[model samples]
Target: MDPKIKSLPTMAFPQISGIAALGFAFLIVLGNVFLVPAGLPHAGAETGEVIAFFTTSKDIVGIASMLTPLAWVLATLFGAGAVSVLWQSDRDRGEAWSLVGFGGLILQNGAFAAVIAIRLALASTTAHDSTATTELWALHDALFMLNGTFLTLALIGLSISGLRAGLIRQWHGRLGLLAAALLFSSATLAPLIMDQAGPLGLLGLIGWLMWVVWVGTYGITLIRGGAVPIESQSHATSSKP
Candidate 1:
């Protein structure tokens, strides 16, 4: 005779959280693959000259190609999809914490967008004027600071979800938290390590891209069906001591 199964406690939050994580991952990869090569400043002999070269060129298609994925990430996270995911979860408490993480992610990415725009603007000012400018450059700096702050907070909340709860079922949360640390440091602290990396840090972008791939792959997995083996209610409950 076939065995009967107990209806395990449903973890609906995890199902939707998995989906959102995928969206974040997609943009990260899209940004790296499409945007970075398409829009990054070209290398000339001197830093200032290269910045000047890119300023005049200002390839709108290239810029749009890069910024498009970023815009999607921002819009999706703030949109109804993310909120629906939060709502569908089993417990209100988990949803609350996830909201904090979601808010942090949106704010951090938005601030980072400001940083990128500011950098492009600064390039324009630096190239056109013979004299160095501070005002536009300072906007970029402040935005970077804000980005770092929000990114750190988001990672912290995700970390708590993994550690405090000891929720191994949320592997994506753990992975995301780790990826955030790598990318955040790469973007913010690369200059301290080397003069060469300077403004365009390679490590941070690489880390972000990897994060995108991981999250996207996981998300696609869910859309094809559900989070079967991992996020399944029976699967999660069976592993508990």
Candidate 2:
């Protein structure tokens, strides 16, 4: 372990992070459950449909938007906790994968913030301003699709690092990697996928579902004290030597 790196409380960090991760997942699922069936507009939705959704479902959108900030906060906490858990192993191996994962979490927070802001802006716009609303929705779709890149990065970095450090089981690591691949594929095809609301959107949706599961399980593992820190192991090894 690097002396420069401040040590985190093993017990507290995992517990807090586990709670945050579960909270984050719950909020996301909650928002989607309400919003998706409420006729939330998809990418390339008709301008009229988009406007109608914002106008009719203003309360739903507002509620979901309100939850977004909290979700972002929880995600950040989870990422920070994950990094702390992986810090010793990463340092010993001369790797910064956890930092990469952390970066992705931060970037995605900003990206999703923009996405929600766009939704709010659209809600406020007059139906008469169809042109502006359409343009705004387009931007929202682009941002939403592109946001997968950050998610992919987060999954890849953390999954690989955690697996290498034996912080997560092989099944967990494989699931994360698979989710990352799906998300990345969706992001890579964003231009095409965003043009029309087709089956391509399912790719992202599936990946997102997997991501939620992955995070939730990770949180559960932490809560159960499954993620043993590499620092403790290192200390044991070093003392013996």
Candidate 3:
């Protein structure tokens, strides 16, 4: 290690990270659950329907958007914590998967910020501005669907790193990987799916649910300090010479 390089205080924030992760998951779920049933427009909703929803449900939409900023903040903190915890193992293995995961987290935060901004813009527009609302909503749907790509990257990077580092359980890693696959598939089909709302949308929805569960599980595990594999323990011992 370079003499000037400062090591991360990895041991100092597992509990805090765990709580942040849980909070991120909770906020996402709360926003979706609260909005979806309150007549949030579907992906293929007609322009008139979209306009009406935004105009009438402005309060609900505002409430949901309000959760997004805090959720993104919590997600960034959790991502940093995860990267810190995996840094040593990644260095030993000559890998940067945790960093990749962190990048994805940051990118998703930006992407979702744009999504929410568009939503708020729509909410503020009058129904008379149908053309503008239609265009904006279309942009929103496209961005929302494509945002799955960032989620996919985050899941894949973290799943691989956590599993290799023995920091997360096999089932947890598998869940993350599975969610990544689903989310990636959804993003790949974004053009087609965004054109029509149906069972196809369920792909991303299922992936999102899995992602939430995976995040929550990871948080709980981190709070418990995780379990080191025997091989990792041996490697650490051997490196101490």
Per-residue alpha-carbon lDDT of candidate 3 for residues 52-140, written as tens digits (9 for 90 to 100): 78888999999999999899999998898898788778777778999999898999999999999998888876644877877888899
Pairs in steric clash, model 1: 13-89, 25-212
Compute the lDDT of residue 228 as modeled in candidate 3: 51
TM of each candidate vs. truth = 0.57, 0.90, 0.90
Q: How many residue pairs clash in each candidate?
A: 2, 0, 0
lDDT of 1 by residue, 1-241 (tens): 3334455555454455555666565555555564346444422124454455456556642454465555545434432333443333323233355456556667766776676665556545533553343444444444554365565555555444433333323566666677677667765663452334345555454555555554464455444443223344344355556
- The candidates, ranked best first by TM-score, are 3, 2, 1
Residues 110-224, candidate 2: write the lDDT tens digits. Answer: 9999999999887776554888888898999999989999999889988888887788889999999999988988999999987877898988989999999999988887777
Please give the lDDT score at residue 127 for candidate 2. Answer: 56
The superposed Cα distance between candidate 3 and the true structure at residue 161, in angstroms, equals: 0.4
Model 3, runs deviating above 4 Å: 1-11, 227-241
The lDDT of model 2 is 0.86
Worst 10 residues of 3 by lDDT: 3-12
- Model 1, C-alpha of 100: deviation from truth (Å): 1.9
- RMSD to native for every prediction? 8.7, 5.6, 5.4
lDDT of all predictions, in order shown? 0.49, 0.86, 0.87
